[model samples]
Target: MAGTKTIDADVAIVGCGVAGLYCALNLPHALRVVLLAKTTVDECDSMLAQGGICVLHDPDDYESFFEDTLRAGHYENRLESVDMMIRASRPIIDDLIKRGVRFARTATGELDYTREGAHSRPRIVYHEDITGEEITTHLLACVRELPNATVFENTCMTDILEGFDADGRRVCRGIVAEDAGGAHLQVNADATVLATGGVGGLYKHSTNYPCLTGDGCRVAAEHGVLLEHMDFVQIHPTTLWTQKPGRSFLISESARGEGAILLNDAHERFCDELQPRDVVSGNILREMRREGAEHVWLSFERVPREELEHHFTHICEQCREEGYDIFSEPIPVVPAQHYFMGGIHVNSDSETTLPHLFAAGETCCNGVHGRNRLASNSLLEGLVFAQRAADKIMRDRFAADTAAQLAVAASERSRFVAGSRDVTDVALLCGAE
Candidate 1:
């Protein structure tokens, strides 16, 4: 028991963020699933996302949303991936609502949609400013209620488990993991998913959880999984600037979407606040350079006091704690490493080149973001593709692959015990929600 333990599951998913949770939720109840987390689920970069999740609120708006996404990515986006995400947007939003997720509603009781940078119109649904929290928390709860799933916080993948099928091809078996007590584990499964999030922790300053060190891509590269756009890191244009260390606090892009503006040290508005993220971040850097200032300003003067209080409760509290009253004055802001648009390459169905292996969320680049990611699209892209990955698993994992499947079982039969951890219940969130 002290050495490497063996875990047998129908599917093993790494990373317990939205992608991981949603993937678990979508899988069939008959399948035993194991979800591994680097830390408690709340620390995921998905929880730090403050802006919102994009959707196709209007049928005619499809063209607008598509064009906006393309323009933001500088037309480097794969047309098929972008089209699939946009087409799948509303259904994903609807699915979240049915899963006990709470979204902000207007006076008429209709779901409220807001605008963000690079968005042509207000089509992003949110829950105040903690949209990611609301969405992922409920999804985590849904995942927790599944009797077939076990979530292991403090467990993380050190590397993927690999074995050859009857065809003599290298296939992903599952992941080699470490538990909270530092015991190695071989989690063998019929299908394996890498939902291990982003590369933000690699930078000295980022808005992501410190654990997101791009482990998924690193291991995927080790297995020679096709990767794309490894250099396409995204930096958000606005984060509350402080000399203090720790994760950078993001000032939601919706702040600008709701009419907040970025200002120079001289109190002059320098760039259009609602431009694509990369464009605005570049602008802020140039302005800071010209003025020899450490940081620029973000003025919420145009935003109503009531709106600030209601829409950005967390932001207001954090700024006040930092000695800035955002309701009356501007907050010092700077660009910081935020999202990774590049990742392990996948297709429209979230399938990587490797057999029985898949990737979703920030760890996998499906070319929807191209060279740059538009605001609030990360959550949508993650959910849409993750669900598709699950669907692909459900549809194809057990179909016409018996020779390879039997080969995988035979290869690992000495160590793997089917459903070895299936009846063992693992806690989720640990009351952090």
Candidate 2:
């Protein structure tokens, strides 16, 4: 093992995806931040998200938007979280624009909107098919230019360090992280945030980076943090079926939104293409079972050829590489583990049950996505909650006097060094939360 190193910051953010990057960007510039990535910053699942992010197009669309989200979640969602995410949509979009992230726009200069599964209206903002990449890349660029922010790639947070506060409440001091070179790092901070993506690594097949194994949720659980909705996992209805043994390529729901159709062995439409993820996945599974088919076929023939080339170029090229011309024929697809709707239970401000610890993105169940996530809402939910976490931390935690901050950090560091522990056992691992 390499020698261990220690560092201090006002905040320590785990994961460098959209949620982590957005949280770091929204933090007060006066406070220093240390952002950690498990691998290269661009290797996150957020960059692989092809579908767009949902937006509340107008005030009048609020009710329908809420209903759509709840319907997709099977009415198990927390209303307040849903409300907060929807209301915060416009401001988040505006902030992204200010940070130089551009979404698709029409010839007349209006924001281009698209529809996806389970949504009642076309309120998604995208940049072709790589919306997540577009937004996350912009956030990464913005974070790189911040004087108060420092990003460390190839740093995996192995465990969250917990210490007792003055009031005897157990709180998170920071984390023990390991880098690719085998150097162990002790990061102590006034606040700690986990934006560590999802549980893709635990699945046989997924539409996520294979490295994401719900590390944040697992660490939180080991520390006795309260988790929620441990059983609710969302399997995407359409992933390009390659019999290969690795991460599956996702055929974004936006294809169906733009007129793709699902067919079984008999080439018959077996289910509503626009249903929520769980519903669609269940329907496909049933069809596969009933027809004795290994995979279902997804046809994009009905979509306009020009739109296919322009909006779904990545998917088209990938399919062609697999020896299937998506424009001419249907491609094989199957349900695969996509997103987790359950995780470390967090409050409205993205605070976990543990004091001084917060979680956002797929790592935490803030309840915006209850039983299932609506199509294209994952990216928006992630950024919205991440910004909220930063907002709360900066305003209430790190905005204190410098003396107080220093004292807190000193105390936490002393306690952490005395304990000196690393997470080696992952017995707390679960199927979902």
Candidate 3:
């Protein structure tokens, strides 16, 4: 048995992925922040997102992007949340760039945009095929440099510590966690944020980190926190197929967006490669069932070899290591559990029903992605809502601090008046004497 440990912070952020890191980053340096990671800080599913993050690009791109998202989500998305995410997209991307994210650029040095499935236009920005890694790593680096932030790796959040606030409202006191050495950890904080990624680890095969088993949602559920769309999981249309599986390697949807196509056993195109993920995945599954095939093929023959070498270096190297030469042959692909659209229910401000508790990323359902997620929207949504959660926390904390200061000032004023009266009365007594 190991000893118990307790720590305190102004804010405790669970999961050190993009959401957690960004949340911590957006917080002021005066506030103490504690970040917990299930494994290494870089092990979250956000690091595996190969496609670029979506952006609104320009003013004219708004309506089309909005409509495309609605259509992809089957109108199950909350309009306000969708609008918030889309409207915030440009600023979020700018923030990433300011944080030293090296997105792909054109010859003229302007940001290069690419199209993805379900997008009405080319609105996604990338750093080759590993955009997630690029963005997440940079954000992680920034968080690491913060003087008020502390990071705990190899720590798993077993559950959230619950209690009642001064007002008798249910609130979270932070989390009860277990570290790599089996030590019990109790992190008490004024605010607790759950950014524990997604639930793909529970699946037999998925394009998510095996550690991401919905810890936030599970803990929130156990504590009676409001959750939305618990069943709204999104299946990615394409991952590199393999029999010896651990984590599924996602074949970037941008591949299809660029020029790649899906072919059946008879080497005939079956599904429109540019449709929404659910539609494309369903078509691929139907094709496989019709032919009794284990997996279909993703062919990049139409994509120039130079483009492949430059844009998909990571994927190409991975395929080559797996004994498949993508340059000369089509690599096998299948659909796998990808993103979760439903999670801990949150309002537009990213506040959960429970006081002082919040969730972001794939762990929270803000209803932006609706029933099915459009390609490349996951990163944007995570970043957008994570900052919103941080902003809300800051706002509440500031208000509380201001009220406390005002109360103290009022008490001081009353005491001063009483003391002055006492002094005046003593002087009057002396005069009477």
lDDT of each residue in 1-433, candidate 2, tens digit only: 2477988888999999999999998898888899999999999988998989999999999999999999999899999999999999999898888888888899999999999999998999899899899998988999999999999999999999988876787889999999998889988898999999999999998888989999999999999999999888899999999977889999999999999999988889988999998999999999999888889999988999988999999999999999999988999999999999999999999999998999999999999988999998899999999999999997766445676888987787666655655332222221223
**lDDT by residue for model 3 (299-343), tens:** 999999988998899999999988999889999998999989999
Q: Give the TM-score of candidate 3.
A: 0.96
Mind sharing the TM-score for model 1? 0.92
- Overall local distance difference test of candidate 2: 0.91
Model 1, span 123-231: residue lDDT tens: 9999889999999899998988999998888887888878897579888888898878888988899889999999999999898888999999999998889999999
Candidate 3 Cα deviation (angstroms), residue 365 = 0.1
Error of 2 at 211 (Å): 0.5
* Model 1 deviation from native, Cα RMSD in Å: 10.5
- Alpha carbon lDDT of each predicted model: 0.90, 0.91, 0.91
Pairs in steric clash, model 3: none
TM-score head-to-head 2 vs 3, winner: 3
Candidate 2 segments whose C-alpha is farther than 4 A from its true place: 402-433
Question: lDDT (0-100) at residue 152 of candidate 1?
Answer: 86
- Provide the lDDT at 343 for model 2: 95
**What TM-score does prediction 2 earn?**
0.91
Local error of candidate 2 at residue 130 (angstroms): 0.7
